[model samples]
Target: MKINIFKNIFENRFSFYRQQGRRQRSRHSQKKERKIGKLKDEIIGLRRRYEKVKKLKRQLQHANLDSPEVKTQRIFQGHKDSSHVRKALQCHFAVLGAVKHKYRGLKNTKSKQSLAQLVSDKLIKKYKCKTYCKKLIGCVSRRKIKRKLA
Candidate 1:
């Protein structure tokens, strides 16, 4: 019956440390899972953005860019006359409704205040409102054309 006192002490200490190590490992795994979740969210965002850009390209592809004379015509400011685009964008976005309410609140209305509700909400304000927006230039041009005589 040879009992080593030093070995017993070391075993007890090591067991405690091992238990602590398990907790640390659990924390580390949780952190890793959070990072993975974030990455997945970012990838989803990128995919949505890619889809939006692809859609814009597809729409632009319908343009007759080779001819300058065909630049400004009718039916959506010479862009395209098709209204079917709503079927595509309406899922992740509010189509025309997301614009004025993308930022802040709609004030006394439904948005969160009827907002949220974004792009595919982020890109709409930054890009779509300016470049790909519907009735933007068209409205301006139409306003100019129909202006009252001074």
Candidate 2:
């Protein structure tokens, strides 16, 4: 019978490779955990913003629509009347709340971008924009008004 020294060495080397493969997998899993932690941090920040928007919406809803202070706000907004502006603000707040609720657990950038597009579409619909330029102009005009007031 021949002594098979080479076969014994090959078997040992194969076992070493298997152990190294398991170590590599564990290291890869650790990296995935770190990425998940980063995503969790991002989610936390988004949730904070979501809470703030929600609180603002609630405050706006409970506000007295016919008060003297609110009347001044209506004049500067360029809408035909306070009621119309209030409705518009309420509609946008609802849309934003929906977006925040739907995207609360989403971690991907593409999903966030899609949510932003959805919000923009809702804004255009609420404002009754006939064209994209008109919507853009409204945003610019609002900023200009804000700057003048400042």
Candidate 3:
């Protein structure tokens, strides 16, 4: 913390001028200095905010890696809203089994998709998972998607 002796001397001189009833206005450069100081303060504030955000990002990337939540985060990445889809799948399998027994003598397998679709439709309204319901049609026909989902 270096003190400017010239600044103190000029301030004392200004006070003395005020006391002597002789007004002494600051130089025109004072306005420019004030604007520059305000700009410096704003720059410092911006740098501090940027550093704080960067520190938080670094902490999240490196330090939070050992946290249990971080470890388990990827475990549930694909399961965001798939509970209803899984339930509908189970209902489809169950309804399939029941329909197979009821139509043991007939060969009406094309209509089986309708039962699964009905289950998916009803479960979507109940679970409010239309975003996930799109996968219903895929899982109904594609064995690979069902394998991945299950």
lDDT of each: 0.55, 0.64, 0.58
Off by over 4 Å in 3: 1-27, 63-150
C-alpha TM-scores of all predictions: 0.39, 0.39, 0.27
50 in model 2: Cα distance from truth in Å? Answer: 3.2
Pairs of colliding residues, candidate 3: none
Superposition error at 98 for model 1 (Å): 33
Q: Which stretches in model 1 have alpha-carbon errors above 4 Å?
A: 1-8, 64-150
Model 1 is weakest, by summed lDDT over 10 consecutive residues, at 66-75
Better of 1 and 2 by lDDT: 2
Residues 22-139 of candidate 1 have per-residue lDDT tens digits of 9999999999999999999999999999999999999788975522123223223635544444323332233344554454454455544233344345545543443333443232
- In model 2, state the lDDT of residue 41: 99
Judging by TM-score, tell me the better candidate of 1 and 3. 1
Residue 15, model 2: Cα distance from true site in angstroms: 4.4
RMSD of 1: 19.2
Candidate 3 at 12: error in angstroms? 29
